[model samples]
Target: MLVQETLEFDTPGRGSTDITRRVTEVVRAAGMTTGLCNVFLQHTSASLMLCENADPDVRRDLEAFMQRLVPDGDPLFVHTTEGPDDMPAHVRSILTGNSLNVPISDGRLALGTWQGIYLWEHRTSRQARRVTLTIHGE
Candidate 1:
């Protein structure tokens, strides 16, 4: 069996949103006993990852590191039509990624105790994002 759905939400700007619960809810709603759960972010300026949800500091540090590694208004960037942070956002996405694939077992996500899914928004302004979840299993 296969189930798919699209989630739309507004991001509060540069930060990570813990979306583990929502994703799990979707998986549960699908009622799949076991399969592959694939999540795809429909944006270039935002990315996804599975990280330590137990510590907010981890999220903060990662954001800080990305800002330092890809500062906005860099003279080397040529894609300036969107804004100063535009190109930097894309760079950050490249550094991270745009999708995640997790295994489903016993009707639940097979994530570690401390691990959680996150939507890392790289843009400086509030933006709407879309995520597609595709589940394939029994």
Candidate 2:
């Protein structure tokens, strides 16, 4: 059987925001055991990842690195209809990721002790984003 759910969030920039608890909730509700859980982000400017959840500095530094790597505004990009941040956002997403797969056991996500799921928003504004979660198992 497979179960699915959608999660929404408002983001500020290209950084990680923990969503592990939400995924766990969906996994428990699905009642799936020993299966695969896939989490996908619906937008191109955003992505998903599993990262260290215990440290806020990690996220901050990651955001800083991305900003430096993809700094806003480039005359080379023609798809800047939304502004300089638009093209940079797409690049950031490509560099990061868009989905994640995790193991499930006893109706719970089997994440590492310090790991957590995150939605890596690459946009500059606090726009609403959607994430799709799918759980497949017996």
Candidate 3:
């Protein structure tokens, strides 16, 4: 069986939103005993990632690292029509990713302990993002 759904989320700019529970809910609702779940972000400036959820510092540190690695308004970027952070946002998303695939077992996500799914917003302004979940299994 295959199930698919699109979910929308409002991001508060330049941060990560924990979406593990939301994804799990969809997986449970799909009623698939075993399968694979594909979480895909429908934007170029945002990303999907599996990160440590136990400590907020982990995310904070990661954000800091990314900012350092890809600072906004970098003189090297040529795509600045959307502003200084625009190109950088796309760069950040590219460096990270826009999708994730997780195994589903017993009608639940098979994520490891402390591993949580996140919608990482790279833009500096609030934005609405769409994510598509595709489940294939029994």
Candidate 4:
């Protein structure tokens, strides 16, 4: 069996939004006993991640690391049409990636105890993002 769905999320600027529950809901709705789920983000300024859900500090630290690694308004980039965060957002997205593949077991996401899905908004301004999920299995 195969199932596909698109989900939209509104991000409040640069931060991580927990989306594990939403994805799990989709998996459950699909009724796939075992398979693979592919989560694909449809934006260059944002990316998806599976990170530690037990602590917010881990996310904050990750953001800090990204900010330092790819600081906004850095002259190294010239694609500043959307302001300082524009080009950096794309870079961040590339570094983090835009999709995830998780195994489905017993009609649920096979994530670790501390693992959670996140939509990481790289831009500095609020924006709407879309994520498309594709699941296939028996």
Clashes of 3: 0
lDDT of 3 by residue, 20-118 (tens): 988999999999999999999999999999999999999999999999999999999999999999999999999999999999998899999999999
TM-score of each: 0.98, 0.93, 0.99, 0.99
In model 3, the worst 10-residue window by lDDT is 105-114
Looking at model 4, residue 23 earns an lDDT score of 94
Model 2 lDDT per residue over 36-127, tens place: 99999999988787888898888888888888888889777889988899998999888888999999987789898999999988887787
Q: Write the per-residue lDDT of candidate 1 for residues 7-118, one digit (tens) a residue.
A: 9878999999988889999999999999999999999999999999888999999988988999999999999888999999999998899999999999999999999999
TM-score of 4: 0.99
Model 4 C-alpha lDDT per residue in residues 40-72, reported as the tens digit of each score: 999999999999999999999999999999999
Q: State the weakest 10-residue window (summed lDDT) of model 4.
A: 104-113
What residue pairs clash in candidate 1, if any at all?
A: none
Q: By lDDT, is 2 or 3 better?
A: 3
How does model 1 score by TM-score?
0.98
Ten-residue stretch with the least lDDT total in model 1: 7-16
Better of 1 and 3 by TM-score: 3
Worst 10 residues of 2 by lDDT: 9-18
- RMSD of candidates 1 onward, in order: 0.6, 1.3, 0.5, 0.5
